[model samples]
Target: MKAFILDHYKKKGPLRFGDMSEPEVGDDDVLVQVHAAGLNLLDSKIRDGEFKPILPYRPPFILGHDMAGTVIRVGSNVRRFKLGDEIYARPRDGRIGTFAQLIAVNEADVALKPSNLSMEEAASIPLVALTAWQVLVEAAALKKGQKILIHAGSGGVGSFAIQLAKHLGATVATTTSTANIELVKSLGADVIIDYKKQDFETLLTGYDVVLNSLDGDTLQKSLNILKPGGKLISISGPPDPDFAREQGLNWFLRQLLRLLSLKIRRKARRHRVTYAFLFMRANGDQLSKIATLIEDGIIRPVMDKIFPFAAVNEALAYIETGRSRGKVVVKMR
Candidate 1:
């Protein structure tokens, strides 16, 4: 099968496109024929070896995280789906390889694609939607009438989060450039902070939660806008000790993570708010609920661009610019 292989980890490294061996499906896995895949900053970070310490994908592996495809075959133990099922997923961290003609995803991570969406649109939802779900819905337990600030409102996760937060009845505020103000507004953001023109900290205060997907500086600033007992969750992170423990790292790595996050954690403590890192996991059940929301028109997919499969490198470059208004997808067919 033709696939893009990462021969080594280098900043702005190019993935080698070539034929590779087919995947061996486990009893709980489904072999999928790739139709489209989504591009994310996480993909670039992994390619640049930023996640080497935690994820540690050795050289010469395929690199991709989000995908929408058709199940061509299901393992004997996979009863939820069968051949010809249209599905989408962010395959579990260790098993991700969606930048290919095919992939074998565990049945537990796969969900039926929303009937209202195309393969490209479906491909864009899993990673970003799951991130928003994990942050606001699962972690924060955001409630109606509460206020939440979401950074990078026009970006993938931010776009999804603004809508989801509004759906959850929280007042949504977000930061973006002038060009994207209307875009975020259409996504149901109640307050728009033009980061280029205004300082969000001056204009906002006493928020229930703040979802940070920006730089360390932005992460630090986010803590101030929240009131006492507010949750400050970051997906771009100096991951906290809890994450290290969840990954079951050794004591050395655990203490290292503690040291890395110590300053921000201390600041959070002083402000009477809680700070934590969010690393989203794959769950078909959550995706199923997200699909229903999509079908019901409560949430819509925000699409930026779709590249041909051959132009995946170009797609990655575009995403790295951090200027895209929404999700960037690579269509395989």
Candidate 2:
């Protein structure tokens, strides 16, 4: 099989495209023929060795997270899907390798692709959509009439999050550049903050939730905009102690994360708000529900570009520029 292999971690490392052994299917796994895969900042961050402490992938591992494909083979214990079933997933951490000709994903982490979407579009939904779902639905339990601020509204997670928040009946505020103001508005953002022209903290107040996908400075600023007892959830994170415990890190690593997030956590407490770092995990059931929303026209995939499989490196470079308005994809077939 042809796949992109990360021989080593480097700040600007490029994946090596070459032949590799076929993936082994487990009892609860499905073997998929890759059609398309989505690109994410997480992919780049992993390549740069940023997640080494928490998600340390040894050298010579396949790279990628999001994928849409057809199930060509099923394992003995798999019953929900069979051969020829079309599916999409953000494979569980440590098992992700979607930038390839094929991958074997655990059945529990796979979902049927939305019938209304193409393979390219479906590929873009899993990671970002799941991130939004986990943050808004699972973690925050955002309610109707709540005011939520979703930062970086033009980016992958932010674009989907704005729509999801609006669908849940929350007043959605988002931050993006002036050029993307209309784009976020189209996604149902009630308030659009042009970060280049205005400071969001000055203009916004008393929010129920603030979803931060930006830098440390922005993360700190977000706390002020939330009302008392509000949730400040960040996906791009200084992972909190809760996240460390959830990942079951060693005591030393847990202490390290505790120390890393102490300042921000204290600030959140002082403001009478709760802070949490969310690292989204794979869930087939959540993806199925998201597919229903997509099929019902309540949410839609926002795409920026689709690159050929051979241009995967170029696609990564393009996303790293921080200019892509929505998800970027690479077509494998």
lDDT per model vs. reference: 0.95, 0.96
Looking at candidate 2, the ten consecutive residues that score lowest on lDDT are 4-13
lDDT of 1 by residue, 146-200 (tens): 9999999999999999999999999999999999999999999999999999999
Q: How well does candidate 1 score on lDDT at residue 100?
A: 98
Model 1 misplacement above 4 A: none
Clashing pairs in 1: none
In candidate 2, what are the lDDT values of residues 215-316, reduced to their tens digit? 999999999898999999999889999999999999999999999999999999999999999999999999999999999999999999999998889999
Candidate 2 clash pair list: none
